[model samples]
Target: MSIKNRLIAMNFFQFFVWGAWLITIANFWFGTKQWEGTQFGLVFGTMGIASLFMPTLTGILADRWINAEKLYGILHILYALVLFYLPQIETPGNFIYVMLLAMCFYMPTIALSNSISYTALKNSSDSDVVKDFPPIRVWGTVGFIAAMWLTNLSGNKATAYQFYIAGIAAILLGLYAFTLPKCKPQHTKAEKSSFAESLGLEAFKLFGTYKMALFFIFSMFLGGALQLTNAYGDVFLDEFKNVPEYADSFVVKYSTIIMSISQVSETLFILAIPFFLKRFGIKQVMLISMVAWVLRFGLFAYGNPTDGLWMIITSCIVYGMAFDFFNISGSLFVETSTNAKIRSSAQGLFMMMTNGFGAVLGSFTSGWAIEKYFTHDGERDWHNIWLSFAAYSLVIAIAFAVLFKHKHNPNDVANVSH
Candidate 1:
């Protein structure tokens, strides 16, 4: 295959492994297993918990010792093994332990895949990586959408079979990873460093700067909002199945397909990012994202599959802006703000705060809130649940606008293109 094809294949399989189960797993827990909400939160919390340390540790090893592709392969193989065991667990508590092990192996590979791709593209003499890479990366979103469709069509969206599907794809990708171009380690013994420094604790030094600290702190707060929708959106829609008038609606019956619209929007929005960041500085772009989040949850608060189809659709559309804007722009911000030496580790730290700490807090807290205030007679009080989320997002948006003080540097925007 050509290099472009290779990258496309890599992107496709990378997300194919995830798409098989990520959105649908809530259904597997709540619908199939009839597990408690808090237990479900624990299951998702494993991703956040693992994100705290696993990615950084793997990044260090990949940087200093193993080829990125080899490490990627090894992790996926291990992830596949763990996933194969997930379906056998009879209780949510035991499943949490198994899923934690799986996520430890799985989450790091997301960063590793990026590393391998950059290395491979740089080595390919014929490729213009900067211009070509985004297109390739978009295919990963396409793969995610495909998996959602498959899960919905196959009726596996609400069953443990989703894990089997993910495991199979992961195993296939693990084998395929061996054939990718080698990404050799860059560090030497002379460069061996302290554990703290290696993990990018240096970025914490930025916290002393008022603006930088506010940015990272708000990033944490917004990150808390990020996973909230993904963790609950499908469940929110699926909840409507109890309503006699809308229970049979295509959306409620096929919630995975409805949710896949968010991924579709994600793909388009990611491509638009370069233009947006260049046109509107980071602050405005991020502010736009916060506003989008308000709408995202607010719409969900009022929408139903029957009378409010447009609102539901609009919420999914806003999701693209809400998600891609923050995540991609935040990454570019990290790239621009930090020094080159610790850039990789700094990015890892950025992810740790958002995906790690923020996600854990969101999952557990949202679960408790839902179990307490949103569940009555086993039916979700979605109206109140969504309104509460909207209120939380509004507060974050207002605070972010008032605080995060970055002067819009037109020159910085121009420099990003180079």
Candidate 2:
């Protein structure tokens, strides 16, 4: 296969491993295991905990000690092993423990995958990373959607079999990674630096600037917004089964498939980033994302499995804009605004803010809020829960607009090396 195709396959299975379970795990937890909502929030928060440090730690290893692909493969293999163990755990505490280990092994690979792909593409004579990488990365979403479909269609959406599907795919992807193009350590022989610098801690200095400080703060807030749906969307639909009228509806049985629409929308939105970034600039694009987030949650607040199904579908479609605009454009903002010396570290800090701190905040707080205000007679008030989320996003959007300031520059797009 050609280099692009190879990278596309790598991206595919990389996320397929995740797609097999990420969105649907809530079902297995709530529907199958009958776990509490607050506890479930902590489960997803494991991603936040893992993201807090693992990526930076692994990046250090990949940058100085090992080939990126090799390290990437090793992590995936370990991840698969941990995932396989999930089927044996019965208690919530044990499940969280096992899941944390799995996340430790898996989350870092997200960044590593990008590193490997970017290096490979840059090394290829015909490849242009800025132009080519987006197309290749889109396949990762396709893989995720495919895995979600497989899980739902096979009647494994609420079973431990989802882990098996994910684990086996991870094992295969891990082995396949060995044959990928080499991405050697770039800083193997770098000048002497402090222990902190060696571990990319120097990126923390970016916080000294007002703009970056505000941006990272908002990133954390927005990061909290991300896990809300992923942690609850599937099971939220599944809960409709309690109503006899909706129990057999496709929305409940095929909820994951419906959720896949968000990923499909993600691919389309990913392609539009450059134009939006060029025309509207980063701040405006980000504001658009914030507004979209409000709509995403607001629509969900009113959506149901039957007559209100369009709201759910529209909410899923709006998810693409709400998600991609902030994530993609935010990455570009980080790429353009930071100095090359600390660019990688800055990127890591960005991830730490969103996936790490933001996720933790979102997971724990939302969980508590749901448990406190949205739960009664052991049933969740998903409508109020969603409206609360919408209100939160609206507040953030207003704060971001009033507080953050950046002049529009077309050159930011030009300099992106497309």
Candidate 3:
């Protein structure tokens, strides 16, 4: 295969491994194993725990010692091994430990994938990477959607077998990674520096700036909103089956497929971001995201599998705005605002706030709320659960609108155009 095709395939399997189980695993926990709600919170929070430091540690290893592609391959292989063992584990505590280990290996590859792609494209003689990569990266979202659909169609959405599917894809990608063009380590030799500097700790300097600090702090809060729906949306839809009128609806019967619309919309909306950012600037773009989150949850709060199907559909569509608006725009904000020397590390820190800390907070709090207020005799009170989440989003939105100060400069937006 050509280099482009190889990279695309890598991106496909990258997300395919995640898509196979990420959204549907709550069903596996709730329906199959019948685990406690708090246990599921801990299980989902493993991603957040791993995200706390795995990416930075792995990035250091890739930069200073190992070839990027080789480390990527190794991580995937380890991740696949963990996935293979997941089906055999019966207890939630054991499951959480294994998943944490799995995430430790898996999360770093998200950044590594970008690193490898940028390296490959920069080295290529035929194309300019800046112009070529966005189009190529779109295929990653396509792969993610395909995996979600496949999981639903294969009857693995609510089964441990979703891990098996993700595992197999990960292993295949691990082997395939060896054949890709090699990415060299960034460091040639050890050099003396401050304790923080040696650890890629210079990224912390951004915390000294008031605006950067607030942006990151709010990013963490918003990041909390990011994973709550993914962890519970399918299970929420499936919960409607307990109601007599909606028990037999198509949505309750196939919640995974219905939820995949969010991914589909994500791909479509990502293309519009350049235009949106150009017109509104990052602050307004982020505000739009916060509002989208409110709608995303409120719709779910009011939606049902039968009569309120449109609300559910609207919730899924708004997810595109909620997710992409924050993540992509946040990345652009970092790209534009930070110095070149610590750009990669700064980006990693941004992810740490949103995905790492944010995910942990979201999973644990939402889990606790669901258990306390939304469950009665093991049946879910999805209406109240979703309403609580909507309220949380509203708080975050209001806080961000008042706290995050960025002047919308038409020229700054124009820079992205050129």
Candidate 4:
């Protein structure tokens, strides 16, 4: 098989492992196990908690001690084992601990996968990562959509069977990773550095750089915006079932699939990243993402399952731009800015800010803010909730425009090389 195809397969299962359960886990937790809503909130928080440290820690290992692919394989296997144990647990408390462990094993591999892909692409004389990667990465979104469909269609969305599908795929992917192109540690004995530097902790010093620090700060804020939709998009749609007039609408019955349109749109937008980055540069591309977030929430604020369904659909479509432009382009920005020696570590820091601290910030603050301000009596005011979120995104976009200092350089497209 060709290298591109191999990487595509890797990306597919990488996200498939996540998609099989992520969107549907709420059903399993609430519908099947009858867990407390407060604890359920913490369940999603596991991703943030795990992302905080595991990705950077594993990135260090990939940079200094182990081959990137090998470490990637190990983490997935460990993740699968924990996932497989999840169905056996009876209590919500136990499930949270198990999920935390599963996240710890799984989150770091996201950065590792990027490291492996970039290294492989750079080594290929025929491949340009900026041009080739988005196409390959688009499959991960496809995989996510495919997994969501399989879970729902197979009647496993509200059952423990969802974990089985994810766990089995994870094990297969773990084994397949061993056969992938080897990504050996770059910092060998020939390179000289101090003990702290030898530990690959130098990646943390990226905070000391003005440009990189501001980029990460904005990334974290955007990450929070991404969580706003993910955390509430479905619930917003599902709540329409509460309205007698709109109870039978397609949006409510097929809320998951409706939300899947975002992922579907992601596949298209991912393929557009190369051109957008070439035309606009990284800062502008991310700024565009911030604006998309504004539209995403604004559309949702007034959308209904009936006459206003277009707004909902449009929000999902806008989601594609809001998500991909920052995530994919931001990674490319990291690739062009950082030294080769700390490539994996730099990716980890990006994930840390966006998925790690950013996710937690979004999840916790949004939940609290919604309850305190958007909820009246016992009912949630989704309109106000979404409006607040839209306002937040607009603020982020304006702040990002004023604060982040960078000039669009066309040569940046070519500079993303080893």
TM-score of each: 0.92, 0.95, 0.92, 0.97
Model 3: weakest 10-residue lDDT segment is 409-418
- Each prediction's whole-model lDDT (CA): 0.81, 0.87, 0.83, 0.89
- Best model per TM-score: 4
Per lDDT, the best of the predicted structures is 4
How would you encode candidate 3's per-residue C-alpha lDDT over 1-418 as one tens digit per residue?
Answer: 8788889899889989999999899888988998877789887798888888887677667666678899999999999999999889988889999999999999888877876776787678785443455556667878888988988999888888899999999999999999989887655456666787676677788899999999989998998998898888888888788889888999988998899889888887777777787788899999999999999999998988767899999999999889988887786677566544454456667777887899899999888888888788877777888888899999989999898888888666444322
TM-score of 2: 0.95
In the range 114-229, model 1's lDDT, one tens digit per residue, is: 66666676678876543555677879889989988988899999887888888889998999999999888665567767776565455566668887778778787788888789
- What is the RMSD, in Å, between candidate 4 and the native fold over all Cα? 1.4
* lDDT for each residue of candidate 2 in 186-217, tens digit (9 for 90 to 100): 66455787887776567687789998899999
Q: Model 2 residue 100 lDDT?
A: 91
lDDT value for model 1: 0.81
Q: Cα deviation of 66 in candidate 4 (Å)?
A: 0.4
**Candidate number with the higher TM-score (1 or 4):** 4
**Clash count (model 2, backbone only):** 0
Can you rank all candidates by lDDT, best first? 4, 2, 3, 1
Task: Give per-residue CA lDDT, model 4, range 35-141, as digits (tens).
Answer: 75556667777788888998999988888889999999989999999998999999888888998999999989989999999999999989999899999999999
Regions of candidate 2 where Cα sits further than 4 Å from its true position: 188-195, 338-344
Alpha-carbon runs more than 4 Å astray in model 1: 122-130, 191-211, 339-341, 410-418
